[model samples]
Target: MPFYIRARTYFKYAEEQMSLAEKEKDPEKILKFTLEAAERAVRALWAIVQVEAPKEKPPLEKILAEIDKACEPDLAEEIKNHVRRIKELAQNPSVEAAKEALILSRQVVRRTREVLEPIIGPAKRVDQHRRFYF
Candidate 1:
């Protein structure tokens, strides 16, 4: 398929995952959707870079560096902490804690999108115009 179509599809999947995470009564599903959202976003970004920058693509470290650069230091640290917690949750998600995880995942998704906007460009952002009220 075409690059733009693929990007849109990935974004849609990410949003679906986000929605599922919010409605998740099962702890495992909550953790799964959190990861699914992050993974889809990262994969979409990488695909965009691969298509747009091809032969001169930026390294993964550089892409992550750019994301980190855009975020506030404290916010970046908090994102990291959440990532670590998500990994732990993947091993075991309790229904009570999973609700909290869903909230944290949404925050991460919002911040991550902000950090990635420059890399993904205006087209993707245009699709995300509707905000998810927390």
Candidate 2:
């Protein structure tokens, strides 16, 4: 099966297990289901990274986490700069800087999407897009 399908199946099973655990009030069952969900999500992302990234990179989750951490501050800085640039450009609009900023913003989005896709699936991917777009 495709990684996405497999991930979804595991997620379904985990959700069912969690529901059962809730009904039974069994803590162990809750832990089991939670672990299963995390494992399946990690596995799915690992598969995607295998396909999308070059070899010699770190493991998928580690790399993703590191990249995510690294990007957080940069993204914040970019947003701040963007606001300033937009205001400045409003007064003295520099097409070149705006274009460069736009390009960098796209790169951030693309990198984030690559890290997020297998973990969250399509609906969440769309949600992320919407969240970031606005």
TM-score to native of every candidate shown: 0.58, 0.32
- The 10-residue segment of model 2 with minimum total lDDT is 33-42
Off by over 4 Å in 1: 1-7, 52-80, 115-134
Candidate 1: tens digits of C-alpha lDDT, residues 35-128: 7776565445445434453456454345444444435777656766765676667777688667666777777677656655654455455768
lDDT of 2 by residue, 1-134 (tens): 45445444544453444344345333344334333333333333344434343445354346334332323556534433433443343343344543443343333333433545556455454777777543
RMSD of each: 6.8, 17.2
TM-score of 1: 0.58
Clashes of each: 0, 0
**C-alpha lDDT of candidate 2 relative to the true structure:** 0.41
Q: In model 2, where do residues sit more than 4 Å from their true spots?
A: 1-24, 52-134
